[model samples]
Structure formats: structure tokens, C-alpha cells
Target chain A: MSFTRPDGRGNEDKRPLHIIYERLDRVDGSARFGFGDTKALASVSGPIEVRLAAEQPSKATFDVTVRPLSSLPGTESKALATSLRGLLSPSLILSRNPRTLLQLVVQSLTPSPIESYPPSLAAACINASSLALLNAGSIPMTGVVCAAGVALFRSTTEEDIPALVLDPSESESREAVGCGCFAFLFRTEIAGSQPLPTNDTPGARLVWTNWHVKDGTSDDGELARAQALGLAGAETIWRAIKQSVPQMDNLPPPPLPSRSTAGELGIITQSDEVSDQDMNDAKIEI
Target chain B: MALQTQTGTSTDLNAQIFQRLHPRAYLERFIKEDIRPDGREATEWRDLSVHVGSISTANGSALVRLGDTTVICGVKAEIAEPDLERPKEGFLVPNIDLPALCGPRFKPGPPSEEAQVLSDRLASTITAAGVLPLSALCIHPERAVWVLYVDATCINYDGNVFDAALIAMVAALKNTTLPTATFNEETGRTMCSRKLRKPLPLECLPVSYTFGVFDGTTVLADPAAFEEPLLDTSISIVLDEGGALLSAGQLGIADKDTMSMCVSAAKERLETYGREIYAFLE
Candidate 1:
């Protein structure tokens, strides 16, 4: 190969990943993600009152802005936001809230040259933002998922065949003509409990937030590999979502009418069930 | 105590009630005694402690406390072309902010005038005084120089912001170590890291002391939060350990006589503050 990375791993393999949640307090949800050298912080706020006129009626809008701390827009931030918006919107039940707006703000603190599937750092950003949304008690979605992209390109010369790149670094992406990205939304479900009614479990529904790739070159065979990678990525992220929303395990029971009414009081008298005092005692002992 | 329906203090109200109800009077009394009802001096600064190397990841960092005023200062340096006008010198940019959460009066937004003026003043004074050796910053002369960003933040405020900020900034610069840069002929790029052993070329430590002159008479050093609103005049002095004044200027309203008196007082204040700075080294 004319260009080989210092590390022996093929261009398709990703760098190691580190994901963090609840990085900021003022925002509804926030996260900081690092993939090798690249670092990104993502925060989400509001299904609150719509401050913008364009976002109203029949849809919960997604507003995303990427800020690069050191330099102006690099190739990675814009591509990451566009792909993340597509992947994340599907996971949100935005159609239910006609006029509400959900805001996503991602800041790239440090730019790393690493490129591979899902752009691990960007994926971390989205994941963190989604968790922040959950923390804010926004209505939940059906499942949680994240996405990544891979590119495959061929050289004009026959001797040098097409190459499969997992995630192309900024330099490499510019050099190649062919590129492909996958926006995967993993289905999220509470691990220990059956699916509850939407009204009861507001934080349980799955909402996809992040997509990342570490490093790779794009070649003809990239799609098949990315799809395969997507499935595994979805499973891992599903596990993460379940871990993030642990409150689903002990949901409050639907509120029941008290015996303040005469008719209800009679029913309470007739029943031989344990008294409130007994329940309180049991709770204290436990 | 009689409950008054009116929103403000009634002149006839009892002294106890008047003291309790009048924020303005409470502030005035606090300034008069140079001592808070809680027994702290108006000019008497709060207990100041400095922690160096707080930001382990940063090139140089320090956390400073002046009474209740808490500030964090971090120094980050990057290599770039020197400004065309000042090719022989490195660049220093100071950013000071009163993040909205710090006080109710501050609105959430961009830098306020107060913050802008402080940062600009600090930057200009340090540069004009030749505190940091600008010549040392020149890597390729006209082609490249180092830009040092001094990010200073006020985490908390009780009063006397300038002194706290200056202390934090100086401690951060003192704690800072330079980065190593190597030119790679193959790539024609210079890789930079925090491995350099040499200290940044420094000329002298410029220490700042701030005093508030109230009613054109009381020159209070390190005015607390309550005094800031009551005071009529304020001044900050940046000086070296050698007792040579580098920068002396006043804010708000004060006559030349009062200003000069405050300046002399500030000279004494710097000696006291300088002792604290030296102690931190130990």
C-alpha cells in the first residue's frame, strides 16, 4: 500500500472509544466524547416554548449547531451533524409534538485526525445529548440508536485496486472521491420491565443520538462492512441506553383515588387488604 | 416591628427596622466601619489562598481565592505568525468574564463592558510593562510567533475583583512551563508538546492592587461586594517587586488629590500583597 498508518490495523478498524454523560448542568442533557485524539461535547435543551417562528405546528424540530473551538468549520463537524440529525430524528417521536422544538448543540473541543465508522467522538456527542434529553424528562421514543459511515473508493490505475476505508481522516476524506455514511438508530427498551404505556414511562422510549468511526480508507467493499458494523454498534448502544435510564425499573404506579369520598370510603372498609400503616411499616423495614 | 405596606424604607421607621430594611444604608454602614457587621474590614481583603497546577492538563494553571472572590487562570500558548505590526514580540490576549450565574445583575450573553475593559487593561498593562519577554516569543521573526492566551475566570465574587484576578493570573503564569517544538523537515511541520524544561522568558512579576475610594475620602483596599455599589471611586495599581509602578489608573469619579493619595496607598498595598505572592512560592 502506498499509504500505510503507523499502527498495523487496517484502515477499516476504529480507534478506541470513551464516552461520558452529564458533562454540563445548565442544559437539559449533555455529554463529552473522545475518540483517540478527537473530542466533542454535545448538549440538548428544550421541548420548551418555541422561541423560533419557523419551528411550529405538527413537528418537534431539531436545531443543531457545531462550533469548532480552535479553527473554523473543518470537514468533520458539518458531516457529523447532518448524519447525526438524520439518524437521531427517526428515533424521536417528533410527530407527536406539533409545535415543540428540541435543540442539539455540539461543540468540537479538539480535532483529531482519526477517521473510521460512526466517528466515535461524534457518536459520543449524540449519545450524550440523547441522555441529556432523557434527563430532562422529554417524552420517550420507541427505541434508541446511533449511526456511522464508511467509504470505499477505487484508483484509476488498474494495478492499484479499490481500497476499503472504515473512517477517513480529514486529509484522507478530501483525497478520496467515493464516500458513504450509515445513520443507524438502535431500538431502546428497558432491560428489566415490559414496555409500559407511553403516558407512564416518559424516559423509557429509545432515542438515537450518536454516530462515530475511528479510522479507515473508502473502497468498493465498504457498505457490506458498515452494515455489519452498524448491527453490532446498535446492540452496544442499546445496552448503554438501558444503563442510562435506570429509573424505568421502578416506575410509580398509576395514581388511585383516595377514600375521601363516602362511596370510596365504604369500598375501602369492605376490602380486607393490608392497611396503609402496614405498607408504610413494610417499606421502613425493607 | 411595624409592618410597613410601602415598598421602601419610611424615614420614621425604627433604627433596627431601618437597618434591616435598607440595603443601601446597610452598604453605607459597612463602608463606614471598613468592617462588615459580620466583622470583616472593607479594605481588609478576605483570606486569599492559591492552588497551582489545578488544571493538570493545561500548560499552566492556578486557582486563586481573595476572601470570597475565587478565580481560575489558565495559560495556553500556541505557535503562529507574529502580528505584522509587532513582529519582535509575542501576543497576549486576556479574557475576563462575569458569567451570569456569578451575580443577578449580569445578563447571560457576550462579554460585558466591565469585563472587556478589565481584560483589555490587564493585557495592555502587562504588554506595555514588558513583563513577559516578547523577543523570546519570536520563532521565525516575521513569519511565526507565540500567542499566549490567558483565560481568567471569576468563579465567585464577594468584591475586589481586580486584585483577585491579578493574583490568579500571575500565579498561573508563574506555574506555567513552556512547550517543546521540533521542526520535522520531512513534513515541514513543527510538532509541539509540554515537554520543554525551560521557563517562559519572564522579565518581572507585575502585581496589581485595587482600592476603592468612597465619598472621596475613605480609600478602602479590597472592597467587598456590598461596598462596590456604594463606592464612588476605584483604582488598580500594577507594579513590580522593585516598587516601580508600572500602571496606575482610577475608575469612577475621584479628584486628582484623592487619586494620588489612593495611588500612594496602593503602593503600600502592593508590598503587602507581594509578601503573599512570595509566600506562595514556599
Candidate 2:
């Protein structure tokens, strides 16, 4: 007997995804991302003055604040914000603006049920923050980050394996035996050139993950398969994001660090010397 | 260069300067030697000690010390109305406090983000892992339920507070005993019998093991305060007595293989340290 999803979607199918850039005018970058009913609005303000205590000499301090709808920001929101900071930091090149602050605020547009696990809300927050960072254009980033939520549902038949569903709806999540949110970093440029279409590309680096099973042990291969499915879902979202933002292609490339400047800053090491030599060769060829 | 010139003569002074100025590089040098600055192996856990029923005022209390990190948890039971939707279920509210006395980094004020995050993680772990069944706390459906407020405070902060705070909370919960509560429907109140007490019906003892990834290669188990900030990626695994994975959380960038390695290591650690820490309760 085949396992059926509550919403009648295929096991691998995700809810409708929506991405809107520049949702707010005041912030440097802003975006609103939604997975069906679950939606999050993220705004980015960065390269701003750093608080005295949070200032880091070598890198920018990143701060994330998550506000839940119809309620004050609580421990749950703070936990989400902490995870968001860690998930989004890998794609951001914060070293470009040292001793400064980059702040990202995420507000949930829809209220999630109190008892349900919030994998969809988490995924939406991450995707919205990624898009907001891209829209800001101030913070240099190595790649675009995307996330997907996967839920494990028990099979109706006794002999069958649990069904893994992507982008689970609120009600679906409530019935899930286990769920996880996985975020991946997709590098847009390879050696200063845009790579081929990423649809067939493998190995998007895993940046963040949070998995929890309500009861009973999961099967050995269940988590690995869920992660793979999450990767596929995130890739689909990445493709959608790429298609929606034509201006992303026209954004100025990140500035290359010159050898002299790096040496003056006392950050250059033996490994950097090789890159410096390659830069000099390229300059001579030009 | 100026710092080196000032402390050139004394190697001790130079070492201190290196630790203060380039903490990450200093830690990397020690990590390359396959040893932490505190003389532990890459996967070595610090000394852990657990003591339960320490406080008499609270219904249940436990003190857990992992290395220099010390966390004390107290379980306070109170009578409250059950939510309308889940009339048969109780509430387990876990809050962690990192006061200014614990460390210099934490200030005395409202709950900081770190404290809130830890509290949230603990609450979710207890709920999702099914450590205790909420239905057991229901004295009368939709009328009154026993609410267990598991509050953990870090008296000394050395690092890996999540593990310490969780261990403390679980231990405290295990030591908790709720009074026999009876609802007086006429008075519309719940009365508790102080003499007759019953322990919480905990289904499983879910133990959590946290590992930090250094230089994206080496995994440090039970990272200390000094090591926590420098490491970017951390993986936490929660396992029950039967070695079943209850919950797992990872922050920052780490590959799947590393995560699996941490899980396997967590299982092995559960057999060794995890058992020893909870042995006192039995």
C-alpha cells in the first residue's frame, strides 16, 4: 500500500513558493518569502556602526532578531534568530567590513500553531534572510543560501516505510513523526564566471540543519534520505530565486584584495602569497 | 610587532599575549598537535559530576558540573488551568538563566539571547523527545494540570552550557515529586496533598552530547568556554537509553559525514559518560 500525504501532494512535492524582493523601503535590503500559508518577512541593515562591546576588529558582527506574529519575541524567536545567524553567516563575506554590524530582522507574517513544530516557518525565515541579503547589495556574499523543510510521516500500512514529505504544511507538520530543516549554500560564480545551470549540479554544501523525532527510533536511512530530499527542495527554491531576480546578475562583483593592502593589514600569510602571484600574472596579461 | 617587542624576553608573557591577541590561531596550533590547551584529546569530555535533591525548598533540584561549568536546576510544581485544545496535557516550561556572576560576558538584566535560546532548546528537547508524558500531569481534564517549571541557572560558565543545563534539567526532573492533586469542583479549585507525593512519569532518559567542529575537520567533544566561541559549527545529538536518536541539532557549516561521526561518538559516549552521570539516580 502506498503512503498518502494529508494534503494529497506527492511525497517529494513542496507547497507553492513565493519570493518578493524589496518588500520594505527603509531597510538596505528586504524580502518576503512564503511557503503556502507559512510566510516570513526579512529586512537587512548592515555595514552600520557596531556596538562597543560587539565590535570585532577583523570581521563584522552579525545579529539576527526574529519576531513572531501576534506575540512578543520570546525564547522561541530568539532560538530561531540564533540558528538563522549561524545558517546565513557562511554565505556572507563579513570580513570586508570590519568592526561594523550587520543586522537582519525576520518577522513572521503568519501565525503558526502553538503545538506544531515550525520547520516551515524556519525554512521561510532562512530563505527570506538570504534574499534580503542579496537585495541589500552592500554585504559581499560568496553564494545564495536556501533552505527546505522535510517531514517524516508514518506509513499507513504496517510493512511500509515512513513517507518523507518536502515543505510540509502546518497540519501535515502536526502529524509528522519527525521533521528537519536543512539549508544549503549555492555558489553562483565559479572562478569569476557564472557556472552552468545548477539543476544537475551536485554537492551544495550543507550550512545548517535541525532535526527532531517525536518518538520511536527512526530508520537508519530515513534522515539521510530526508536530507537529500531537502537538498533537492532547496535547489528548486534556489532556481526560483535566481529566475525572479534579474538584477542579481547585474550586481557588481566583489572587490579582490590586493597583496599590499593585505600585507599592510598583517593578514597575509604564505598561502595568500600564491594567490598574490596569480593576481600579478593576470594583471600583466591584461 | 609592538606586542612581541614588549614581551619578547618572557615566553610565558608571550604565550599569554598570543592567547589574548590571536585566540583562534593559538587554538589552531594546539589543535594541530591533536590536543586542546586544557590537555584533552579532540573528542575528550571534561569531568562531569551530578548531584540530585540538593535543594529542599523546590520540589526537585539537581546540580550538574561539567568541567568548570556549573548549572543548578530546580523543578517547581504549580497548579494551572489546562489549555482548551489540549485539556489532558500539562506544560513543561524550561527557562535557563545566565546571571552576571556566572561569567564576564553575561550581564545582569533580562534573559539574554543565549539564555533564551538554551531555554528554548531544553524545552523542545523535553517535549519532542517525550522525556515525560504530559498526560500524566493532568489531574482533571480541562480543570487543573500540574505545571512543572524547570528553571536552570548557570552559576559558573565555562562553556557547553546547553549540555550542562539540559543534564541539570533532566536530573532535576527525575528528582521531582508532585503532590497528589484533587480538583474540588464545587469550589472550582485544585487542592494538593503535601503528604502523598508521586514522581513524574518519565518515559525515557534522553541524554544529549554536543560536539564542536574546529577548522572544519576536527571534532571537539564537550567544548569548553574558550573553545565554544572560536568554533563555528556545533552538533548536538540526543539519544535515549536504547541508543535511539531522539533529536539532533546542528548550527553552522558541517558535512553529513561529520554529523554521522558525531552521532556515533554520541552513542559511544552515552555508553560511557552518559551512564556514569545518571548512575547516581538509580
Candidate 3:
């Protein structure tokens, strides 16, 4: 049994990713990242005077705030901010500036449905924050953190098997039995020196993962498989980030290729070893 | 001091000092004994109580107590214009306030991040569970409708404000009575008859259960203020009256088995605690 995606993309296909660096003025650094329709604008202002109560002697105080598109920032935004702070903290060397503050603000650019989880928004926020941090160039970072979202769906006929879809759209998410966001850190400076883990690679170090499952009967192995798919999707996003870093200095950031040409542009490449059909299998059967 | 000197035991420490220094370790010692510092079992919940219609001024009101935690919820109804898209539907706005008087951690100011998050969670949960039918609140289409402002105030913050606030909000809504209303076409206003009133129509009752995981195991039900911060992960499950899951959320890392365990435990709670709550309201 096979499941068809609402956006007509394959099970492993991701939405067209768009990134615009330094989109705002007056801020130290800013970036607008979009996963198809879902978008997030993130800005970084760091190493500033720390608040008296939040000051730390050994490391800088890292703060993250998230604002929703239309409504006042609420628990959803606060939860997102906390997740972002935890995911991005490992990549930053906060010890460089002691007793200072590094503040990052993320603003949502799309109307989120009240019912389903916002995995795409989370992925976009993490990616935009990473870009903003890199664009600022003031804070030392261990690596660039890239993220991807994957959702699991099971047909009524084949209740035992659930298919994993990468970068699910809003409508698709409404039908998801479970969904997760996965992030991986990649050191850009030493890209080719070592055989850097690509989409098909098995050993990409995970930075952070969040999973929300609706059905309690779902298998645990499905979560691991969804994460593996997210890792591959994140690698695709990392390649796009690598392409955009070199073009940051130029005015009018380069426009990303459309979804059709993404594969040809090497932004979304599929490995020959693992095919989409193989991933659709219900069980590993090992 | 004299007792310590006489005992001459280096490991001996004051109870308060031990709790203040290594809070996690202090809690872990209790968990190892299969009990909490407050003398509750691992899966045991705090005592819960509910009261309704205490505030005569508001349309409806309820006060709920879960152990030392306390929350009071009041519902106010006002006539307002409806949205263009949904002319027949009214509005249900729910907000939770955690003031400085509740606990020392909160300062007197605008709503803190925690409070805002709690309010948002409450609002979303109520909406997602379809607890009330908005169209039922409409006195007339498009021109005038009853806008319900459901406000929950925390009088004391021991922990698990989510569960207490939600219970209070649901009970208050259930207790609400709306006066008979008439929309006059010529006057362009809605008038209410104070004598004739009807109960707000509630579709279902949704109850939430929150659990905190200690040391990657030992799920603690309804953790107190002292146990909340030290736990690594917290999971919340919302179930309707029919034992159907409305929503499930996890803050930190937890495996699939843990999540399933929490859900099953929540269902069991819904059977016993949920019935007790409804029975009190009746």
C-alpha cells in the first residue's frame, strides 16, 4: 500500500527551500527562510550588555524569543524559543564573551493552523537562526545547524504500516499520525577534507530532535526511520546553505531554483543506493 | 548544632539544606523509595476539589484546588459583532493569569512567558477538543453575538497550573447561564432579559493529565512546584469524556514506550479522577 502526498511530492522529497540573508537593516544580522509556504524571519543581535539578573561570569547569556504572525506571542512561540535555544546552544561558543548577552528573535511569516503541529515552522526557525548567526560573524560557532521536518501517515487499510513524508505541507500535517523535526550540525570549513556525511551517510551527529505522536500504538522503529529521513532532508538543506554562504556579500541574495530544477542544480540530490520504494517498506525485516 | 556535633556523622545534613543544595538528588532519594517527598506514590495524584458559581457578578465562575495549587475561573458574556466569514459563530476567548501573589518566582508586571504559554495552551486545548459549540452562543447572525471572555486566575502556584486552570475553565463554562437576548433591527442593538436564562451548551468534557519523568524513568503524576523544575521531561495528555485522545504533547526527550505509558495512565485517570470531578459538579 502506498500513500500519496497532498503536494504531489514523493515520500522523501522536500519542499523548495528559500533563504534570504541580511533582509533587514539596523539589526546585526537577519535572514528570511521559507519552506515552501511556511516562512520565518530571524534576526541576531549579540554580545550586548547583559541584564543584571541574567549575567553569567563564564559564558554569555543566550536568549531566544519567537513572535507569531498575527497574534501575540503565546505558549507555542515560547516553546519554540526554548527548543531553538537548546538546539543552537551547542553550535555556539558562548564562552568567548563572558557576562554578555546574545539575543535572537524569530518572527513567523505564515498563518499556522490551530489543529496540527508546526514542524515546518520549527525547522524554518532553526535554519533562519543558524543563517543569522553565521551572517553576523561575531559569535564563534562550532558548525552550522540545519533542520528538516518529517511526518508519518498510515492508511486505514494498512494500519500496521506508516509512510514517512519529508517537509509535509499544512494539509498533509493535518492527517499525520506522528511528526518530528530533526537537526544536524555540519562544519562548513572542513567540507571536503573528510568525506563529510551526505544525505545517504549513516553517521551524521544529531544535534536535536522533537517528536509528537498522536497514536500510542505506533511502532518505535518508525520514529527512528522518520529521523533517518529527516537527517537526509537536513543534508539537502545544508547544501543549499553552503551555496548561499559564498554569495552573502553580493547585493540582492541569489534566488533559489524552483522545485523542478532543484535536483539539476544539485541542491536536492538523491543517493543511488537507497531508493524511495525501499523506504516505503513497513518493516525493516532484518 | 549541638546535636550535629554529638552525632559526628559527616553525611548528616539538615533537611532544608539538603533539599536546597542537591534538589534532584534529594528528589531521587524519594523516588528510589517509590514515594515523593510529599508522601505520594509515584503514579499518585494530589487531592483535587472543585466549586462553582461563587462569583455572583460574573455570568459563571468556578474555583478548583489541586493540593496547594488553586485557580479561579470566571466567564463574562458581552454582545459583539461576529466575524464576516463565520456569521453564525460567536467567540470563546480564554486567558490564564499567574500573578506575583501566586508565587515568589513571578514578579508584578505584564504576563510572564510562563503565564502566556499557559493561556495559549488552554485556549488551544479548548478549541481543539471542541468543548463548546460557538454557534450556540449567537443571539443573532452577523450583527450581534455573545463573546465569552473566560479568564482563569491562579491564586496559588504549587505546580500543574495547566490541569487546575483547565478544570476550572471547563467547570465555569458549564456553570455559565446566558440571559435571553433579542436583536432589534431598527435600534441596531441586542437587548437581554435578566429573568429568562439558559445554560451554555457544552459539547464534551476534555480533561488533561500531566506527568513528569524522573531520571528517564518513574513517571510522577501531577508533580508539585518543588518537583517540576528538576525533572528532565514533561508530558501532557488531553482526553475527552469518551476516553478519546484530543492532544498529546512532550516537552523534552521521551521514548515511544514512555509516551504510550503516559497515555494509558491518563486514560485510567480519566476513569477515576475524571468521574470524581464530574460527580462533584453534579
The top-ranked prediction according to lDDT is: 2
Off by over 4 Å in 1: A1-286, B1-21, B31-34, B184-187
lDDT of each: 0.57, 0.82, 0.79
Q: Estimate, for each residue in A1-286, the C-alpha lDDT of model 2 and write its tens digit.
A: 2778767888887777766564354789887788877888899998899999999999999999988877687678878888888888889999999999999999888886553338988999999999899889899998888999998887655776777899988777777888889999887445545557534543578888888887757355666778899999998888667654653332432332344433222221213345447535533542
Q: Rank the candidates by DockQ, best first.
A: 2, 3, 1
Clashing pairs in 3: A75-B117
Evaluated on CA atoms against the true complex, candidate 3 attains a DockQ of 0.13
Q: lDDT by residue for model 3 over B51-157, one digit each (tens)?
A: 99999999999999999999999999998999898999999999999999999989999998788778877887787567888999888898999999999999999
* Fraction of native Cα-Cα interface contacts (under 8 Å, chains A and B) also present in model 3: 0.12
Native contact share for candidate 1:
0.00
- Residue A211, candidate 1: how far off, in angstroms? 56
Interface Cα RMSD for all candidates?
27.6, 1.6, 5.5
Model 1 chain A: worst 10 consecutive residues (lDDT sum): A264-273
What is the docking quality class of candidate 2? medium
For model 3, the local distance difference test gives: 0.79
Query: Isolated chain A: TM-score per model?
Result: 0.58, 0.81, 0.82
By TM-score, the candidates rank as 2, 3, 1
Question: Which one is best on TM-score?
Answer: 2
lDDT of 1 at B137: 71
Per-residue alpha-carbon lDDT of model 2 for B1-282, expressed as tens digits?
664465566656667778888898789889988999999999899999999999999999999999999999999999899999899999988888999999999988888878878878888888888889999989999999988899889999999998998889989999999888899999998888979998887898888899999888899999999999999899998888777888888888888788788888998888776777766786
* Candidate 2 stretches greater than 4 Å from native: A51-54, A114-117, A188-194, A198-202, A247-286, B1-14
